[model samples]
Target: MDRSTGSGLSFAKRIYLPRSIGLGIGFMCVAAGLWPLQPQPWVWALLVFNGFLWPHLAYLLARMSKAPFKSERRNLLIDSVFGGFWAAAMQFNALPTVTILAMMAMNNIAAGGGRFFFKGCLSMLLGMLLGLLTFGPAFNPETSMLQLYACLPMLVLYPLALGWVSYRLSIKLAEHKQALRAVSRTDSLTRLYNHGHWKDLLHREFDKCRQGQHRATVALIDVDHFKAINDGHGHLVGDSVLRLLSERLALSLREDDLAGRYGGDEFCVILPNTPAVLAADVMERLRQELAEVRSELAPHLQITLSIGLAGYSPMQLDANHWLKDADQALYQAKRQGRNQVVSAAD
Candidate 1:
């Protein structure tokens, strides 16, 4: 559905249970306050309906509305109206009136912040006017022990329910943020680390190497005649080749190894705690495996990789120098022969 409708549905679902619980328990508090006034039978009936039945009806109204979020907001206002009516009906008894109005205000603030809270207050004022007209204005500030006891459940349980809903919302937001971070750092085509994130890791690895804390090797790999393949077979076939290479890299590399798409047809890898000699052997195996593979999309097309390796050296002035060494080695591999692995240290 559209954004507005999706938000409305989510808002409705979040509010429904808390509304049900609050109203059900609130019935006792209102009833206890009204009991001293000897309210008419119709008033009692109205109280019962508002306390027990209105929550479900409100939920149905919101769910069925074309504008559910707006409908739900209207429902909240009605709840505030009812709260005001009950407070006035109780002759503004200190405990029950405060409990009812406080709960309604809490809900309003939580739902829509300060602006909605003020709207709810206006609605409550309108309700108070209605109650004044119906019951005739009077004030009874005293609260019986029974009324105080009746207010306890709503005061305690409603906040807890609202707190739980807020907590769940916070957790879901955190998970979404983490997922977005991962997506931002990942290449869409190959599901490998994108160029920027890989370079970031390279910088960190370079720092470790410079500090003499670790040894690492960097490799740059380029697809052989990738432009020709793309021109002959189409970009779709070229994509399949890249995806296939990435899958093999993921499967072949150690868990600590980092691989990323450097750009168009070039990929980069960082092998931590490895020497150039060992890295060359690893790349040679990878190169051979890729050369033997054929793409399902272009079965007649053969794929090969030219790889260059550079082991960390204390003499390197910066990460860029180390990367330049690998790039030079990659150029050397391409010049010597398209399918071979060459090491800068060699």
Candidate 2:
């Protein structure tokens, strides 16, 4: 949901209430400036509307608009206009005028930096002109202690509130970035690491094994006659078969073991600090486990895994060479017969 819309309030909307509360205080300072003049009923009414009701009204207007986010930005600029008009109406009272204008400037800068600052300045100036045209120019350089105290609350509290909002936004952005990275590395169907991520892990594991003189095993497992299964059953059933295998495979592995879906009907695993024999035993157990699985679509369908297991050798030059050894073993398993584990020769 758009945060700007009534469906959901966004971060900006979340910050607005604190800003409005501070603004109400700032407007009270403006009223203090205008008090000595004993302004007319219309002026008093305008002050009440701007000081008390405008913030809520602006939020609702944006929420009701076709594009709530965009409308909210426009509303911000309108706020600037009103701020400028009030500053002028107060006869450019030095303390109140500066506080009102500075707050508007700070708000625009926070929203869009220099660009929005410029646009907001333009709106403010236009509003100042409207005030000047209606009521003529007047100036009061002095401000009372009460008026100064009235402006103090906004100056101190508003920035702290805005800072909190910005901090939360940064944290949210970082979390979203992390989520996107995870999504990129994962396969949609199997919810396992994708081929590229698996390959990266393989490379890293190979490096660690070579550097630390540790044993690691790599295995490639293929679903025997997967094409025939898809042909016999519908694609939906074929997908279910893959999901079941992926789930069972995950459950069969140890905490430190890494598994990934290499492609259609082909999955890969990496086992650290394990010899070829131990890897073979693990793969064999996994094979039997998979064979016992009964498909919902065709309960009696014979399903099995052909796995090729190879341990890292010091003589192997690179990750690719080690992978090649496992691939060759996998081909040997298929050639010998489906549904068996083959260990590659060192």
Candidate 3:
């Protein structure tokens, strides 16, 4: 579910029901107490809806599914489940009590962690605060200034606690998400960007070049006689050689250069803002670095790479056409005896 797009907001909206409902209930009750609502059936109904029914409903809904194991919905539902249970408990008990208030505060903190902590915590806290303020006079039967000051803890402590916990959890979730995204874009074996990511990024760069009135180069490199390496040294050594070459290419390439495992012993390097001459120089350096690394890994390993180079075409829509042209040139390099660089423009 490529949630990286605008569609990702839909995922968030799906799980918002429970928390939103609980928050709504809490808000109404708090509002009623603070705004001087005269004793009325509808106002009382509002209190009951906010304090008890909302949270309870959220909790019950969360328990219905055990699908949290593999989806992001699980994370969203987690908040709903916790908030719902807390809401339910509040309904059967005294709303203006410190114990119930504290529980609500803690539940809000847990439910709204990740990038959404502050907003979530504030939302839940506001609901409870309004509810308590609205119902405080009714519960305590005291309207004195001193009595109201004494009850101020009901307003502050819960929100503060909610804020602290939610913010902390938000940090943790953000870190976890970043780590996951990093792993997703990387090749497990070669530690370079995988083939799919390579294609995506290449096209993206190509688009940028088209808009910018600038140029970028793409180089396709194939390990010369890779089949023989696998046959003679076995797949394990072949794997080791590929890993070493990937590392060397990554380390030796300039910061603007992007390298990818295009599949098997083939690699692709996209050099942005580079002309053919500069790209050839870069590739020559890469060839030397890779050759040295190959010698170190296996003394007899004489691996060589045949490279085909092409540049961005402002007239072309995407990089695929240019890539195909580079690929044909690469085939020519192999035909003309491997271990050489061939330029499509040549």
> Number of the top candidate by lDDT?
1
Better of 1 and 2 by TM-score: 1
Query: Could you give candidate 1's per-residue lDDT for residues 21-126 as a string of tens digits?
Result: 9999999999999999999999999999999999999999999999999999999999999999998888889899999999999999999999999999999998
Q: How far is candidate 3 from the true structure (C-alpha RMSD, Å)?
A: 11.1
Error of 3 at 219 (Å): 0.4
User: Which residue ranges in model 2 land beyond 4 Å of their true spot?
Assistant: 1-12
What number of clashing residue pairs does each candidate have, in the order they appear? 0, 0, 16
- Compared with the true structure, all predictions reach lDDT values of 0.94, 0.86, 0.64
TM-score sort, best first = 1, 2, 3
> Comparing candidate 2 with candidate 3, which one achieves the higher TM-score?
2
Task: Give stretches of model 3 more than 4 Å off.
Answer: 1-147, 295-297, 314-317
TM-score of 1: 0.95
